[model samples]
Target: MCSNLQKAMIDLIEVFHSYSGKEGDKYKLSKEELKTLLQNELSGLMAESKDPAVVDKIMTDLDENQDGEVDFQEFVVLVAAVVVACHTFFEDLDKGNVTPCSRS
Candidate 1:
């Protein structure tokens, strides 16, 4: 049986592959694919940002080779960055440095 972390890793691979290979490339994500993946899989994360250009910004930042597509390596960097950001948010919340809810 795989550990939880192993399962998570597998799921990430599965999720990436599910969205990828649907268009022109079998191993990379085109801009549209990335946008779909973000909107469908990471809706909450995407919803946090108000800027309409957020997806464009993310695509540019993640397409490290300037190939107009995001490969697995580039995708991993994005996952890591997002995970780090989430961890930092939780850490801050745990330390009471950030407000969890501001009741009106």
Candidate 2:
């Protein structure tokens, strides 16, 4: 069985490929492109904290090496975090621990 982390990584890759319109493009992402993509496609997932400060803090925290942007590895980490958050949220719902709600 694939670990949750591994599954999350796979899901992230699928999302990235879809966003880039290059499902087969495994090429490295430029810093600017990465930032833009994250801000656009990942805003909702990352914004779940309902706090801009928290979201910004998470973004900065993932930008390791102080490069002012995220690389593939860093992006993977960010996606993994989002995936975990999503999984936990769903799991809570499954257990009837969370109110039934939809973002849309």
Among the numbered candidates, top lDDT falls to 1
Clashing pairs in 2: none
For all predictions, the C-alpha RMSD in Å is 2.2, 5.6
Give per-residue lDDT, candidate 2, residue 21: 27
Tens digits of per-residue lDDT for model 1 on 1-104? Answer: 99999999999999899999888898999999999999998898888899999989999999989999999889999999999998998899889898755335
- Once fitted onto the true fold, the runs of candidate 2 whose alpha carbons sit more than 4 angstroms away are 1-35, 46-55
Worst 10 residues of 1 by lDDT: 95-104
Query: Per-residue CA lDDT of candidate 2, range 41-103, in tens?
Result: 876654555664764575578778775545567777876776798899889988989885554
Error at 12, model 1, angstroms: 0.6
lDDT of each: 0.93, 0.65
lDDT of 2: 0.65
Superposition TM-score, candidate 1 onto the true structure:
0.92
TM-score per candidate: 0.92, 0.57
Model 1 residue runs over 4 Å out of place are: 101-104
**Candidate that scores best on TM-score:** 1
Error of 2 at 94 (Å): 0.6
